[model samples]
Target: MKILIIEDEKDMLQNMQDTLVKQGYIVESASDLDSAISKVGVYDYDCILLDINLPDGSGMDILNFLKKNDKTEGVIIVSARNSLDDRIRGLNTGADDYIAKPFHMAELNARVKALLRRKNFEGSDLLKIGNLCIDSEKHTSTTQHGEMELNRKEFDILTYLATNQDRLVSKSALAEHVWGDHIDQADNFEFIYSQIKNLRKKLKEVKADIEIKAVYGIGYKLTLS
Candidate 1:
């Protein structure tokens, strides 16, 4: 999973990034509104942890930008502003959840996981495709025959493809989602192909019901048998 943390406090931002990264998410940050808007425009994230107050403008406005752009990334308002009106406005404006400042990191992590589960798997932790089952939280998958474990990048690739399902995911989008900042440094898609190849082999080894089908000259799609 990938997360973008939009927070102004340096300590808080670093803390959130560290915690989420430890929890196995690709995390990035923006300390102000402009940077946040720019990042949101260029990249897609599984979840965005947004602080209501920023150095430049209200995070509420960024919510509008996200909605207008039709980005499906889940938003969780993490604000020191504990006003009911602020909470209502954030949710009304399209936030998936809200967290007040001085909150426990455990609670924040739980909310993020719950939001991802709801967004990606329709409120279920288990992503079921035919006889195959994937549990994102546990980072494991299983078939009728047995269970399988994928490395970080391979698991990320599988999760990204599963989120898009049958939709053809372009190489650029897949790279951004899985590789994040490192995607810019990669001169070619050799890494993506390598990871997908490994992931495919593992799925086949486990007798998975789904396949990652390449759409020659375009992208790859997740197809169920």
Candidate 2:
């Protein structure tokens, strides 16, 4: 999954990013409100870790922007302000969870995983589609044939598609979600096609009951075979 960290403290930002990356999530970050808005404007994320205080502006605007735009990304406020009023304001504004500063990375990771499960997997770590079972927390998938072998990108792609099963996913959105900030450096979406092709081959090998079907010039969708 992809995560966006909106924070001002350089040390805390780096710590959060590193911790989540170690947990096998594609992580991106912005240190201030402007950069945070810019990122949220472009890409889609599974979860967002937001700090209400920023060097330039309030992070509340970002939350409002997300709500106004109807973006589906789960948001967790990670602010230093732990006041009852502040927590209430954040939740009322559209945050899914809240955690104060000076927190354990483990707890933060747990919150992230919980939010992702609720938002994407129907409050469970396992996404069961046909004979395929994907454990989001473990970052692994199994079929009736047993566990399937997939590289990082392939797994990310499969997970994203599975979450949006039966829906057509645009190539650009897939690239942005899976590759995060790095997709800006690419000139085309050839890499997405390549990854999908390889994932299809692996799915076929395992005799998985799911199929990723391409829509020619559009993108792809995952459906039960």
Candidate 3:
């Protein structure tokens, strides 16, 4: 999953970024409201960790912008403002959850995982498709035959396909979601093709009942074989 951390505190922002990265999430961060708005406008995220107080403006403005534009990223207000009014305002503004400062990284990780489950997997940790079972919490994929050995990008691609099973997933969307902001640095989508190729071989090795089907000119889709 991808996460955006909008925080002004240098130490706190770095800490949050490092923690999420260790948890296998693609993370990007902004220190002020302007960059935060710019990033939010241009990219998509699975979750956002927002600070109510920014150097340039209130994080509330960012939330308002998200709502006005109908962005569906899950947001958690990670701010020092812990007053009831602050919490109410944030929740009313569309934050999915809130965490006060002086918090543990483990707790923050848990909140992110919970919000992702609620948003993507219908609050379930297991995503089952055909004979394949994916434990999103554990970051593992297995079939009735056995576990599939996959690299990080391969697993990410497979998980994404599982989430959108039976639906077309545009290659650009897959690259953006898996590679995060770094997708802009790529010259072409040969990298994506490479990952999907290896993932397909692994799936076949495990004799998974699922398959990743290419859509000729547009994208790919996952379906039962």
Candidate 4:
């Protein structure tokens, strides 16, 4: 999953990014409102951690922008304001959840997971397709045959492809989803192709029920075999 942390506090932002990275999420961050707005406008995210008090504008405006644009990314407001009106206002503004500062990272991670489940997996930790089961919480994929050992990018690629199973996913879309802002640094998709090749071999070894089929002019698709 990809997360955008919109926080002005340098230490706090770094801490949150680092924590999520360790949890196996692709993370990007911005410290001010403009940067935050730009990111939310362009990129797709599984979840967004927003700070209400930004350097230039209120995070409420960010929430409003997301709603106005009809973006469906799950948002959790992380703010210092603990007032009833603030909480009510945030929830009413279409935020999925709210967390106050001085919060534990573990609890924050838990809330993020819960929101992702509700948004992406229909409130389940396990995302299953055919015989393959992906424990998004544990970041593990397995089949009836056994566990499928995969690197971070490989697992992320499989998850992304599986999420859009049977649909032809463009290479740009897959690269952006898996690498976040870092994808801009790559000149071509050889890196992505390499990961998909490895994932396909692993699936074959486990005798999995799905296959990653490449489309010559476009990209790849995951189909049940």
Local distance difference test, per candidate? 0.90, 0.91, 0.92, 0.91
Candidate 4 C-alpha lDDT tens digits along 1-225: 899999999999988998999888989998999999899888889899999999899999999999999999899999999898999999999899999998999999999999989887889988888889988877889998999998888888998888888999999889999988778678888888899889999998888899999998689999999
Q: Candidate order by lDDT, highest to lowest?
A: 3, 2, 4, 1
TM-score of each: 0.97, 0.96, 0.95, 0.94
Return the clash pairs for model 4, or none. none
Q: What are the per-residue Cα lDDT tens digits for candidate 2 across 5-58?
A: 998899999999999999888999999899899999888888999999999988
**CA displacement after TM-score superposition, residue 3 of candidate 3 (Å):** 0.5
Off by over 4 Å in 4: none
TM-score, cand. 3 vs. native? 0.95
Worst window of 10 by summed lDDT in candidate 4: 179-188
The local distance difference test score of model 3 is 0.92
Q: Considering TM-score, where higher is better, how would the candidates rank from best to worst? A: 1, 2, 3, 4
Model 2 RMSD to the real structure?
A: 1.2
lDDT for model 1 comes to 0.90
Candidate with the larger lDDT of 2 and 3: 3
The regions of model 2 sitting more than 4 angstroms off are: none
RMSD of each: 1.0, 1.2, 1.3, 1.4
Q: Please name the candidate that would achieve the greatest lDDT relative to the true structure.
A: 3
Ten contiguous residues with the weakest lDDT in model 2 = 176-185
Summing lDDT over every window of 10 consecutive residues in candidate 1, give the lowest-scoring window.
181-190
